[model samples]
Target: MLTRPISEGNLLTEHNVHQNYRPDVDGLRAIAILGVLGYHAFPGEVPGGFLGVDVFFVISGYLISTIIFRSLEQKKFSFAEFYAHRIRRIFPALILVLIVSLLIARNVMLPNEFAVFGRHAAAGAGFVENFVLWRESSYFDVATTLKPLMHLWSLAIEEQFYLVFPIISWLAWRTRLKWPLLVAAIGLISFLVYVFSSPISAFFSPLSRAWELMLGAACACLAPKILAPKSAGRSFYGSSFSILGLFLIGLSFFGSLTTSLFARPVLINVMATLGTALLILSGPAASLNRLLLSTRPFVFVGLISYPLYLWHWPIFSFWTIIEGKSIDLTSRVLAVSLSLALAWLTFQFVEYPIRTNKRAKFRLATGLAGFMALAVALGLTAGHWGRHYDANIQKIIDAWDFAGYPEPPGAFHDPKYNFVSWRANTENEILLIGDSHAEQYINAIVASLNSSADRPSPQLMFYSVMSRFGIPQDLLNKIANDQAITRVVVSYFWSIKYGSPKIDYEIRCCGTGLFQTVGTKGGSSPSENEMRSLDAELEQLLTALRRDGREVDVILDNPFGSDLAPRSLVRRNILSGIQINAGVALSRAEAIERTEPYRSRVREIATRVGARVIDPMDSLCNDTGCPAITSDGFPVLKDYDHLSLSTLIHHVGYLNFLR
Candidate 1:
């Protein structure tokens, strides 16, 4: 039987190693796990449910510290045993989850996607999921929704803490000093640095997250010394305090606190630390501990929390992938039931036996290592198999002669113009400027112009399309000098240009002083500003390009509401008399209507600046409407309002203006 007042430790309350463990501590885990689940299941229902992770950090600190302090105080600290227990507890379930997920994923994922899954699995096994995720989270990629192992980042943080904290606690015990104070200070500093970086970086960085874990460690160090009956503040109002703390936690979940609100990420770290401390510290108070967290239901959920957390996200993610859409109400309910059932089974069959039995733990670890190695090998082989298939597919595409030739150098040949493929004759020099939309057409225009042997090879150069106007400050300085021999073509996505009524132009303007500073430093000719201020910069660029022995051609932006669905599917649906959603079909149709107003704006600006506006609205829209998909079964848009590569190639003739 476990004894009471197990040992006299610095932080351990008078209770010995054999003393009864607090059931309410598990109840707090119950609260944390449930809050997180509720948030993921129905985001709007509990927006702050993410705070549950904070609560977990605090509880972990309390319990783990209690155990460590007692062992150290009794001069029985065993690093080997501690680590063994940790490995047994954490890795078995995690490896099992990853293996199962990889097996399921291989059946349906694309070869490239499967390769990605394998990589994540390997990374998770290596305990660096957070680093993998941090590197990948950017606007250029679909970062968040894709990774099934994304949630493993928190566990990784905890594991890291577990590794470092034991060593630190051991050192502090040997020194008989307040070494935890030094640790807390370091954690605070690291958290500050994390908050200073990008939000995603702060979210993933181990250094940044260390404070939350350290907060728990500190509480563990302090709890015993402070809670002793002889201590000055040892008056027991445990039940009331626990109730108040739980209420605060609940209140926190209902509030609108978000990562976005924190000016510094460290602020959130601090808040989580404080909140967790209060909750954990109040847990063992008999009056509160008995009534609140001791409830059987709360304790039961806490027991199964680890398995439930592990299983939920993957099931949800896979369901979304297989359904090719989000889950509706019934599906969500079913998903929940399935998740719960799996959690219960895993707990009963796997976690419980391994945890309670020493020999069973050893067997379980051996079996898991074998299974994981087999799964990884199989996953790798599948990837190899898929790559071979893809290479063959590429060969077929080459055989079909779908792969095109490369274009030559000059303005049109510049890599900047490669995406757009703008073609030019020997008689004309073209300048393409604007955002990505304008830059995208350079290659087509250049290729189309080059295709004609009769036409003089025209030169083309594309400026930064994302620049606020045709002229960024860097280019503005250059254009004032370097009188390049002649014709100027300005092609930009004018609809999304700076000074548009919808977008704030000031915010859009970047790199304005770069060109001017370059000019002042004798880097190039002094750039003449036709429009002295940002508002008139576009018109100024047009006039300046003309003044310096150049003619200007401004390509108008394309239709704005293109969908990603294949054009062939859309046309086939129409022919088959199948009804599609009115919202999707009409959005494109409405986009076509907006062209006239956009055209008028372009014409008004072009007329004033003596530039010609090349509008492709007529080519894109038919009498009935603007088609989302092409007749050949290609998606017109890659995303909400931009054309896909195939869509751009099909409309290569739209570059006639460049010729």
Candidate 2:
């Protein structure tokens, strides 16, 4: 993620309020942008570079607050003029990026991918991209690298803050409120939310991010009182503070490599924010500020930093999408180089003229607004139109739809637990328990039973659990109270629960035109404590189920990897159109190797609890390999791991135990 700093030279020019430009601040911007660029282009080398966004937030807060405070004191602030300036400064580069992204996406993306991109573009235009991305960070969401506009989330947060903060400042100044005290109170509440909220919310929520900006605001409000009438020894103290600030920032950038983002976000954010504030407090004459920050190269990068941030991620993302996998170092370097060239061109031709043209400011603002509205319209239209595969290609695309499950006629929601259930004519019942891995088999069980006229169908009750915990009390009570329930089926995506390293497999097609698997390892494994907790929870669940005198059957997790994903089998080229590679498969030996730890752990527990162990690999794999597509050309997996509706209905008979 990256954020654009406020334009220091133009902040006060609207109101004829003079503030000296700090070249060191521009130097600081150079550091922040470079950090973000390093993280996106070479994550392994610069793991903590994402903290750059925090640095930008502080810079934005200090610069924008300074302008507002100074104009208020002079009684020259106007809401209309302030927003017009914002439009001029921020809109040109943003509008250019949005239009260009939409154009590129229309040609390169599949129908579903295009639809998703359209919605994201609309969110970006509306300044709600962060909320859209937050909601999409779920089990079934597309991979992050596939999205070109994902970097807009930080821009959305900054714009959202600007929308409300200026009004609050105006009201506080008008009423003669203690601005510093008010800022501190609001900032403290936001910081608490950042510290206590869920990981996803803490990362994307505006409330959780506001405190970083407030640190800069506090500096602006108190700088006059603290820095005025400097003593003879002030220069020495300034140099020391500046040096310490740089050290803290450098430490956070490198220290984050070993730390999980969710494990200690408070420490990382605080170091970056406080470090930025201290550097500003140290004044321009500080030794480091004069020698390092005021250098020409640093200031030049700082000047074009906004456009550069907007350009880099999309270039890298598109490259990944086109190549159908993680790119090589040469590709990354070329992308960065291309982004720099585009950013410099955009600043020279598009941004500079629009921002500096004082006489046409009103017209330029109005035109930019109109163009933004048009971008939103185009995005909405794209989403509404959905996928547009050719008739033959569409049949292949339709086979991957995960929602093709046939709903049973008697299906209804359980009033007590709010889960889906269906009653059969007979008194026999089968209770399905666990996470989504269990739910995926519901339709398959129904289909299997319906086709088998000789057997009696049982009532299906699914209990979906989000985490790896033992069956809850409410679920246990239902089993105890219902005598008709004779069978219990348990399943889960156990490799994920038992902390297996995620490996993404890509089916690539190039000049060779031969489909081959390329695997890339990602995500961290769970700690020893987490693994122990999961083991204990699993044992408790099985023991309780067996104690009820029911036939307990534990179905092992299915063989899955990115190679099995439907998207991996399909590729789009501008000249050739859709290319389907249905021969993609994973070797049975490798599948077993990947899932052996989970299978061994589950088997040991089930054996002790007297539960029957069922393995899906018995049907999904053969002596050679497990194919992503069936013999008839239907996709087996909807995503990286989840079984498709078509797969459950026709490919495997593992769930026949339910009958």
**How many clashes in each candidate?**
45, 0
What is residue 532's positional error in candidate 1, in angstroms? Answer: 17
Worst 10 residues of 1 by lDDT: 511-520
Worst 10 residues of 2 by lDDT: 508-517
lDDT of 2 by residue, 1-659 (tens): 11233354554346634357788888988889998998888887877788889899998888778878788878887777777777888889999999898877876677776888999998888889999989987634555677789888999998887778889988988899877976898799999999999988998999999998899889888777656655411578888878988887887777766656635778877987898888888877787877998788888788888999999988988878777777899999999999999988888888877877868778888999899888888888885664466654554566555333456667887555566777554378777887778888888887877776786677777887767756667777667566777888888888866757754433321111112222233357777788778888888877777765778999888878767777678775644545776578999888878886767889899988899998888898887888888766677777567787778888768777566
Best by TM-score: 2
Model 2 misplaced regions, further than 4 Å: 1-13, 135-143, 178-182, 185-189, 192-199, 222-234, 257-263, 385-387, 391-407, 412-438, 452-558, 572-578, 588-624, 653-659
lDDT of each: 0.59, 0.78
RMSD of 2: 6.5
